[model samples]
Target: MTKKILGVFVIAFFMAAFVLFAEDAPLAPSPDAKGDNFLLAADFRNAFAEYRKLLLENVNSPLSEYYFAKCVSVMGSSGGAINPEQLLDIEKINPKNAILAANLLRLKTGSFLKQGRVADAERVADEMGFVKDWLIIGPFDNATKAGYKKVFPPETEFHTDKTYEGKNGKNTWRQLSVRPPFGTIYFSNLFRADSYVAAYAAVFIRAEKEQPVAFRTCSSGPLKIWLNDRLIAGIEAYRECDFDQDCTAGRLKPGWNKLLVKICQKDGEWEAALRITAPDGGRVEGIVLQNNIDIIKKEILPAYIPDDSDTQIDADSGAVGYFSKLIENNPDDHFALAGLAFMYDFKKILDENDKTVSNNARKALEKNPGNDFYRYLAGTCDEDRNKRLEALLQLSGKNPPSAMALFKLSELYSSTGGGNSGRRRAVSANEAEDITKTFSVPMPFREEEFLNAALKQNPDFVQASLALVGIYNRRGTPWSLEAEKISKRLLTLAPENPVIVRLTYDDDLHTTAENAGHYAKLLAVDYTDGNARNYCIYYLKQAGRKDEVLKEYRAFLQLNPFASSIYQRMADYYEGCDEYEESIACLNKALETNPEDIAAFEELGNYYLILKDIPKAQENWEKALAVKPNLPDITEHLEALKPKEKKFWEGIAANPVVYAAEALADTEVPLHASAVNCLKNEIIKINPNGTSSTFSQQVVKVFDEKASMNINTYP
Candidate 1:
């Protein structure tokens, strides 16, 4: 009884402190003093209303904005559309609300997608960037909180290490990529299961301007956050994973700031998602989120050239120069040599810039004969095709082969004109360009074999899985089932990986509206990637979401207005919906965008025929045919629509519908016949639901008005 009273007293004291704190500044309690209670009671409306009232009371409060955004977001997600402007308002009030920013941005994107405002959603996604990568270290036991408490006596010790590896005496770290929406990590992935784990994740954000940034985080277990070594917020007990469950506001210095997280998990699922946002709960513009220590260090380096260098050197050159200086001091510096070789490899034209690359790679390999990276570098620098292959083959033969080496080997084996003895090379340029047929010779080395070897060496390696999935999706010998299984496994392992999602989408194994939306969301975790656009658009169409399809089509065109094909696609979609005017307009725009778009001309020809403009139809079809003399469908279409003689009509009379269609095409004489004949022809072209047919209503209205028309005579 005494202990219970003491606990009550402690809670009361904290509540008092919270009230006092609110009066002093804008901090609010989490479990949210009132909002969480209302939400728990299933009174979402009241919860949302209460949060809104709090926001109105304190416009600048991160606490109020956070709760309000959450309430609105929940309500919006449940069939109600959220206002993007309201979400943006939260950002304006507390830009450092990273969790809220990411959540609200997601909510806003979904709303935009549902409302057919995909462009707005895409724009907001670009603006509200998620902290996609983190230097993750852990799986240290959290038994009785022992592991969590002792992992780092003070978390700052982890940050204090200046090494680019970001490793300290306390723990070994791996750079983990966690994209937004669903990117997560499992304790079992790195350590034994059914055990407690303490994980540390940290990322560096370089802000362009000084502002208060919010770090909103969600995790499966208890976690604490520190900004630039200053302890800011912490949850000491276990909890279920929830989005934006905890957030801490901090002032980000104009330049670089470090955000560190310590998560304590007790068995079961383990994961976390975090983001940094502007004071108003929007993206902190000009912020670069980085996990790679080398990248973080390089980003923070002074932009000005060293006084010794005569000319200005960009960051890349500066990096190269720094390594060059290191090499000048010690010619046998393997690290410097490896760095130079990697830089050259990144340039993608290693053969063109071979001066120091080959020498440096050779020196690095000689110095570290056992290092796979050194071997890989040497292999990249080796100009001899046979020698390069030999080095790569040797690298792959290591105890645990590098994924890069395996990937390179796969590429060499897969390429038709390379080391792979694939069939039929081009006798001429025209022959090479013609893809009408293909011949193949069996490859000496199967790409799939090496990719499978890479996967066996490191099952968690995503690139290997992706490569194998690609092989499974190869044109003639597509192994769709294997691809689907691998893709699903990849998603399970790395939920937020856009590359995996791209492959999954490419295979079209699980194409649905929801999956497409998720795929698009995953893509948004990175900067706007055009690679997934077609898949996203295709999935939406397959799911019968015409509104979303059109919205995305418009959005894509906004970004790439010169894409004539997109305009043609838009026209096709509009025509499918029986929006003839809109279809015609799209075709005209396609022509305007590119006069030589043969497909657009063909589509316009079809549109003109539907409108009964025989001359215009013929003109457009002729133009299409002129562009490409052998347009298969165009010639057939033109021939089919040509006016036929009585004998031809008789020949096709068994198909009366075809005869009626031909008769209807003769617009020279109006058919003042009973409604049945016209209705018969009209029914073939109209959708009962009125969505797919523009003339459904007009046809019905005409039928109603013609109620008095002759029942048995043609006028």
Candidate 2:
């Protein structure tokens, strides 16, 4: 009994000590000692819960509130709800805790920016003194190891000297007048150049004091940087340039500072843009810079436009004048004819394009009658069955005929109730789209046998496998297992190639969320494919899992920031869910990505109209008109909402005679005039008072507007 009492006293003493320690201990900065690893791991819900608990324990603790706000920001990054009350509370508690307040504001600013609230974001950013302008230089030749050192010279004077040009093609500094959130610029814009042009950019900045500033830059190629004449940060290889891709903190001096960037380009695009701010990504007032020279040039060499000839093609007809001249000079100019044929085909001028295609095919056949490729081309271009059959016979008769020849032969055979090895089989709808040929009578040719023969010729032929997958998927036959296996193998063999994903999806391999997720994972392996990523998201959304859609798009945007269309998708998704506010925000963001996007403006106009903001809708449509005039629908919509038109509607109810006179004057939208006429006839028959006639006219107008609303369609 004495020993048990002593043991109880010992346990009570230990528990008392623990309680005292817990009471005295300060709150942890995050759930984990290091920080919120949950957020880093993308477990936002749990992280949010942990932060909530911390805030509850110490309600007024600024750090806890700041972290909690971050959790909110992360959760709401993809159009989730934001608690304005909580954010405003953080604003109220500022100056008492400067760091915490700044962080809270930055989070608020980001939220505003994401939602396309540029005015709100700029207001916050201005309060913070964010750097919005800089002077830039370069796109020099940095293709070699020796070229690299020349970009960032070892000499200190290299930065201080305005006249200094390095051993390679580095040039003097030039002024770049722009703000953050801009798209990648082409090197060809500044000066005429080939595909693989490299350059260096330098900026001279002045700050009021020595302080840490948030530094960010985007480049469409490999980039290296030196700030204050010292190496700061860099991305060593080619990447899609975007805001905050290589974002970091760097120190600015009390006076003059130099920032040098070396961007190495291989092809596609060549340019960079920079942004600087406070450590919290807020504005920094009094940051300034000036340069005498602006290297920007207005000329964009016509040769630089993708697939366009230096000589102008007929824009209206999509005809290549240069290729036409080349063929005119020499009737047997097969290459020139083929080029024109391809251009026409790309423009979808099929009738004209097909004639050129047939001409080229004929010329190629004349050049080499034994060439299976030429024979196949002739077969493909010709619509007549007899002529196509003649080309196919020639193609098949060649020694070691190509896989393409066999595939084409199979497609023709499958169109008209063909069997495996001439054994008759039933036609399926799944096979219809793949087979270009059609016939009333059954053709005794085995489509599968021809396909198998092609596979035997080249076992690793991707096209053959894709064709087979399509047939198997559509038919839902026992061959589906084989199709699945082949798809899996193709994905592995050509992991870097995007064709596998396209073929797999085309074959309906990603029918379920689980299977679609597999494809998303595959696409995630490479950073190049935004369309493939979107394709997977489409299937995932179709599977009734829309919650994951925003998350996936946010993740994709993080990697491919220049894919402005993804923002459009997010806006569409939000709009469909009846989240008009979020949709509006996304449309604003889309404008930031591509300011000239007419579709985004049109959509924004429609959203405002839905919200009953007629003036705002008109403003957006006017902006769209400024970008592209002669949009009949926009013109019609504007006519109805005009202040003059609105007055007529109100006056029609107030003074029927005056309103009817005004309505008859307007001629746009025949339907509107018809409705007005019908209303006038009713008003005349009744011989009602002015007010009653006006009321009746107004009623008809409402019905007419409602009818138009029912048929809502916008580009």
TM-score of each: 0.38, 0.35
Query: What TM-score does model 2 achieve against the real structure?
Result: 0.35
lDDT by residue for model 2 (1-715), tens: 9999999999999999999998676433213322243332223445455655554454444334334444454344211222444444546544334334544566676656444454676677555543344444443445552344453432243432365443223355444433433224444344333245556555557678866776655566666667765666666555455334445567776766666666666666666655565654445677775443431222211111211112211111112344567778987655455445433333223322136667676774665454343455578666575678667644554455445556667777666454444334554654543333432222324667667766776665555666677677666767787787888777764544555555555435334766667666665554335666666677778886777788778865554455567788899999888898999998887676455567888888888877767688889989878756888877756754543333333444332333454445553434564455546544432232323444444444543655444323311
Winning model by TM-score: 1
Residue-level lDDT tens digits of model 1 in 484-594: 888888777665555666656544444486678765775465334556667778888888888878877876665545455677788888878889879989888766534
Candidates in order have lDDT scores of: 0.57, 0.54
> Worst ten-residue run, lDDT, model 1?
304-313
Q: Which stretches of candidate 2 lie over 4 Å from their true place?
A: 1-395, 398-405, 408-447, 458-460, 472-516, 526-531, 539-564, 576-582, 592-597, 609-614, 626-715
TM-score of 1: 0.38
Best by lDDT: 1
